[model samples]
Target: MKTLVIIVASLFAGVVLSAPTDSTTKDSQENTYSIKVSDHGVEKEDTIIIDEEKNIEIFQTVDSDDAEVVEDFDAGLEGIIPRNGDSCYVKPLNSGENIPPAELKSRLESSGSENVIQEQGDKDDDLYVLAGGPIKNRAVVGETIAEKCEGRNIYWLTLAEDGHQDQGRVKRSCYLYYCSLRVYLGKGRYYYHCYIVRYLC
Candidate 1:
């Protein structure tokens, strides 16, 4: 069954750190969102460009030691695009109400997640897949963990390019976590990867 729905419209706006020395132009889409940058000491307005998939293109540039990195959308959270210089990643999840907790329960194993993708031979770049079942609160489950891994507190594991995340500092706590269920549909056999993240309480 297909579980992913791609939104093909412009949805957000963001600041690009240092617009390349070459040029800075506004997109045809006329939707711009503003954000307050505490560090830059200035409020910047962002331009939003919607693609065919409705995935928001937030124009933000991160300055790396080697070069300037341009990011289209928020890498950590959807709906809210990150300001330039903000260190984070946002990946859009499959959004809808059809995903039920029961379906989530059937998909995940209690002890360990499946199709674990490991980390590359580096400390910073890594990825993995986390899975778990339904939670007591259906509302929370609807947000992140969706119906794919329903019936238990939301849980997830890290998936890196090479394989499962396994290294120093980048431990299980760093990758695997429990939070309000957030769901996203991917391009292959597996449609969902549940991540239950909890910030400082």
Candidate 2:
């Protein structure tokens, strides 16, 4: 009987010692986000989990088709940009000349308007104009300029014939268009229009 008791006690102690601690169990738990994407005849799904710091911990993918399309979920713009074609021709702008940075600053300063400033992105490929004036007046001018260049892309306060902006906006009270273009060149022969715009405040 004493031997049986000792054996049971040893088994219980072993179980307790092997049990996972609270911290270990919590660390094993993960927060996951899932999404299903289906287009045409292809269906794919992804399950991503993050750690305590909100960083991706595990990226699990399950696909219906046995094909190697699981990686497509992480491939952005993989199938978007054309892979082949003749390069697109971009036409010249009939209006708005490319103004130098110094010239742009000079024009803004000569306006004799207080609080006149020019802002550009880190790449310095685009510019935005801010003038201290009534909001109503600025809106009117911005609307007019936007209308005139309705189908065109603007960059650095100049107008371009082609290209697209990630964000388009005219200054609050001035006719300022802040535009940025991102071009992706691939091995395939493809034609695209690239344009930049410059607007004076």
What TM-score does each of the candidates earn?
A: 0.20, 0.18
Model 2 stretches with alpha carbons more than 4 Å out: 1-24, 63-201
lDDT per residue (tens digit) for residues 42-97 in model 1: 33322222221222323222111111111222222232122222222223333452
Top candidate (TM-score): 1
TM-score of 1: 0.20
Superposition error at 69 for model 1 (Å): 10
For residues 2-65, write the lDDT of model 2, one tens digit per residue: 1111110000000001111222244344344443322222333444333332121222433211
Evaluated at residue 192, the lDDT of candidate 2 is 16
**Worst ten in a row by lDDT for model 2:** 7-16
Error of 2 at 125 (Å): 28
Q: lDDT for each of the candidates?
A: 0.25, 0.23
